[model samples]
Target chain A: MSEARKDDTILDVKNLQTVFFTNSGLFRAVDDVSFNVRRGETLAIVGESGCGKSVTALSVMRLVPDPPGRVVGGTVTLEGTDLLSLDEAEMRKIRGNRMSMIFQEPMTSLNPVMRIGDQITEVLRLHQEMTSREAWAKAVEMLRLVRIPEPDRRAQEYPHQLSGGMRQRAMIAMALACRPALLIADEPTTALDVTIQAQILALIVDLQKTLGTGLILITHDLGVVAQTAQRVIVMYAGKKVEEAAVEDLFENPKHPYTRGLMASMPAVISFGAKTDARLNEIPGMVPSLTNLPPGCAFAPRCSLAIDRCRAEYPPLQEVDGDHFAACWRAAELVGAP
Target chain B: MTDQRPLLEVTDLVKHYAVRGGVLRRRVGTVHAVDGVSFSVAKGETLGLVGESGCGKSTVARSVLRLVEPSSGAIKLNGTDITGLSKAEMRPHRRSMQIVFQDPFASLNPRMTAGDIVGEPLGVHGLATGRAQQERVAELFGQVGLRADQMKNYPHQFSGGQRQRICIARALALGPSLIVCDEPVSALDVSIQAQVINLLIDLQRKNDFSYLFIAHDLAVVAHISHRVAVMYLGRIVEIADKTELFANPRHPYTQALLASVPVADPKAKKLAPMIDGDVPSPINPPSGCAFHTRCRYVMDRCKVERPTLVKAGGQHEVACWLNDGTGRAENS
Candidate 1:
């Protein structure tokens, strides 16, 4: 690879929009969202359920269902190639070869009938053009890379035979086996215990650094976003409310929604400061996407909402160097001492 | 306003399920779900039980409430041993102990209105009826941060957070002294989770009821609990005051559990996992210490000798050889 290409962005998404035509009406599950993933960078999309984080990921992968859901608009540029313009056959060649995804609940995602080793070997054989024996060896090596004990023996076991943690490790192995440039993990460790979560997270970070894979992690846990992500995008009602470096987001959140999330989460380590006071709560629930409030979607629930906020949606603007927030009162937050 | 007497005391609780297999349905093996667990919740105190899935924390909660009859144990409520009481005899005892489950959507009856669901307990206990029951139900709803007008709504009509509030209202209708909350807030979203936690804390302060709060989130437990008990496999490995336990965990499992929690700070450096591998199955748990399979400081003695919960210092108690001062000298 050329020096310039080595440092180039792996995934560039612009004006991404996905909608679901439910029985009630059409709702924008992913409103015009745009973000870029640099080479070997980890970009986290954090939001509660119904915030369209998962839809954004599916739109990027071009895996959105068409009958009820579709990526109505977007320019998903992968390594200078517009993935949105590719045909089904062409997209298939690029999917497992250039980008792959890890889903939550490995039991549902992984083939229960197939052996773990055979499942991974299938991906390698299909995308990498490897022979049966070579693929089998590589599958075992990938399992070993994920730190699975007795990789050779475990490869022959079915998904049910492994524990929950092991099943997730197998999923990670399968996702990274092809060494795709972009890896999208949706709530990868939400089902596992904290200890198991720690192990899996450490393995993913270590492997991503070694393989230089651009990771797009979608999760609701702020703690996870703080620990792993280099950059984060905070979504609310299917729109990007805030985007900033991980440190800046935690230290100085501009959007009221982002600030609410940070305030609500009970930090495990408070550096000796006592938090006996009542936890700050975001007053109303997330509005239904189909019946979102006029103008700003978050205006109803936001404490900093002004008359202008209810009259029109606030355009996402730069609050600081590279820190963007879509809030009418973001200037007030920045002006705070 | 705290009392010396414990609101609920559980001693030597053991709940085992016999796994039946083969054509004749013979007992193939025994799953020691809750093996010799013991704890006490003082009056007006909240005891948080923290553990991973399949760690028998749920079993402990159910046993305390007599929802599942323990295979063997003594469960005393306000100095009265209700463990051996029959269903008819346990009716009044049930009024003193209620439970709030994790999934409010599944726990609540969809057909019933929120008011009826909350009032059912009042009707069941024969405590109130007619206008009195309606008033009590409305008051319960208000206490949990729900509107009285919404009492006519069904469980499906409410949001996830609202459903949990209904569950809390139902749990509070009986005016129980001890409420066993099993992951009551885990199902709610992060923003809504804080609302429920704050409500629970405020309710505890006003009502002065003891709580057996079972959860996997250490931070939530640390915030709400007066004392915390860490369970691994089927045993309580450590129990201590919230601050003491969080600041200085004595057991290796407790320490690892704390270190495993991802700090909400990007600048915080990542540390290596203290232990590895998944939690072993409860049916065929390791011999000696249940956590020995994942302990970073494992020793040969830990493989053969089981450690019992012993006083380490102050109010803290740990069931590890490293701190118990028995098997460590020989191994060292």
Candidate 2:
């Protein structure tokens, strides 16, 4: 949890800025975002749709293509080495080996033409330089590790022959084939059903514990973060508004946006209560990144906004022990810890 | 219990699609998409149908509406058996029961404006003409939380939440007593989802319209439904009051589903035994209990003899062999 921990700093991002140049204008999808992932811990980047949570994860893996999106500034350091400085070949070597990423949709991520085992072995053969027989054996082992039933039979089936949950398990098996130290799962359980989602979550938790792998979970659902994440970072309009321990963030959120999100979520405890006429909601849509306000991006919709909030941008200040919030009136609005 | 006449009732409904194969295209198998499913919505109650994808929840919704013709069953709307009614004969009852689809973008006609979309039902049923149709459309716009003046705007001009509101207005044009809402809020953002849910609740209160709300979201379903029916592999595994279903689910599938929902409270530490393996395909479902393949407490007989839905307690029914007073029933 510390910035100076020697073995804890698995992935460090500094002043990351990602911009997309389109026909309309230049838009900052991720603006000066900075965060860190500790070894063997889950760090969740939580936000609404289009809050740069996914873009930050893509930037970390260098997955964003060059024509529309470009990393204009910042550094991504993995195990004390700057990944941005690496050449294409070196980065490719590091991609599936040292750091791997799982996409949102497993159905679209897996190739339909390739068998599940071949796809998994493709990574092993490319990175580990193993023989075909050895790679196939390793692929079967990986499938079994992911709890796939009848691993030998499942390995020979194509991606289309599997169900949504099975395809996701296969995707995870492929990502973990090289035993990466850092895993970036982008909404891995978003499209899955609740029962299957719980299984997948438990699998990730078990795998992280077994492998001591650092995790960066990006999702819009607060429920997923509450169940899995250790530390939480809240983003809005491509800016980090709050960061705190998972327990502290939910119990005593320091930012208005975080409070609104928590209040808007319908919980089992609050079911069938006819107490209030109006539920807590943040009015208005998220502002376009291209047309962001100069000072505070959320000022237009924030009820507690003041003149000072509209004149200057607020810095992320440490309000409590290991808790950071970027709001001018954080202490007044949320009360001092 | 006081009123025996429900707005909509489905009894022993079944739908199967024949799978063809080989060079001559012979029917080799049948996919039992909806097999012997039954549920009912009272005069003003919202009955939520929730399950995983490919669990036949949508098929039940479609069958009740007679959209995809049911192979065999009885669907009664206002005491009239419309299951065997021909297309021409069923046209009169179309205004009594309507549907609101999940995807607002795909459901609404792109070339038509909001006015035309909402007024189509009115024109089809000959309920109103020219000026009256325009007035009805404007009134519906205001009812579903949209501005009457924006009726001329197209679906493309509205946000996802607003477009769904337009769809709701269209469904309300015929003054239907029942509305089949199939995942209406699943495609929307969380904030917008709350808005749409609240709107649906409000409309139901004001108009006394019953809803067969089908969705995959447990929390949202628990919020708006009076009674809930949990489906798994084309079967209604559990049916009970919303409070009882959430608090004390009897069926194993329902228990696992309720347990899997991530609680908002950080201090909560309850975890259920997660079901393993994917749901078996309906085309070739397991011989006995379709859920036995993934169920944690699967018995030997579960792999051979299917269970029947029966009354367990007060207003609660379950279709599990465990609740039938026998550890496992003998296979026939």
Best by TM-score: 1
Q: For each predicted model, how many residue pairs clash, with residues at least 3 apart or on different chains?
A: 0, 0
Candidate 2, A94-187: lDDT as tens digits: 9989999998799899999999999999999999979999999999999999999999999999998898888888998999999998999999
Model 2 lDDT per residue over B146-232, tens place: 898898998998988899999999988888899999999888877778788888888887888899999999988887788889999
Write the residue-wise lDDT of candidate 1 on B77-109 in tens digits.
Answer: 999999999989998888888899999989999
**CAPRI accuracy category, model 2:** acceptable
Candidate 1 per-residue C-alpha lDDT over A1-337 given as tens digits, one digit per residue, 9 for 90 to 100: 2567455788989999999999999999999999999888999999999999999998888899998998888799998899999999999988877999988899999999999999999999889878999999999999999999999999999999999889999998998898899999999999989998889888888899999999999999988898889999999999999999898898889999988888898766543544345888999899999898888998888877889999899999998888999998887795211
Taking the candidates in order, what DockQ does each have? Answer: 0.67, 0.45
Tell me model 1's lDDT, rounded to 2 decimals: 0.89
Q: Is the docking of candidate 1 incorrect, acceptable, medium or high quality?
A: medium
C-alpha lDDT of residue B327 in model 1: 23
* Deviation of model 2 at A334, angstroms: 4.1
> How many pairs of residues in model 1 come into backbone collision?
0
DockQ (C-alpha) of model 1?
0.67
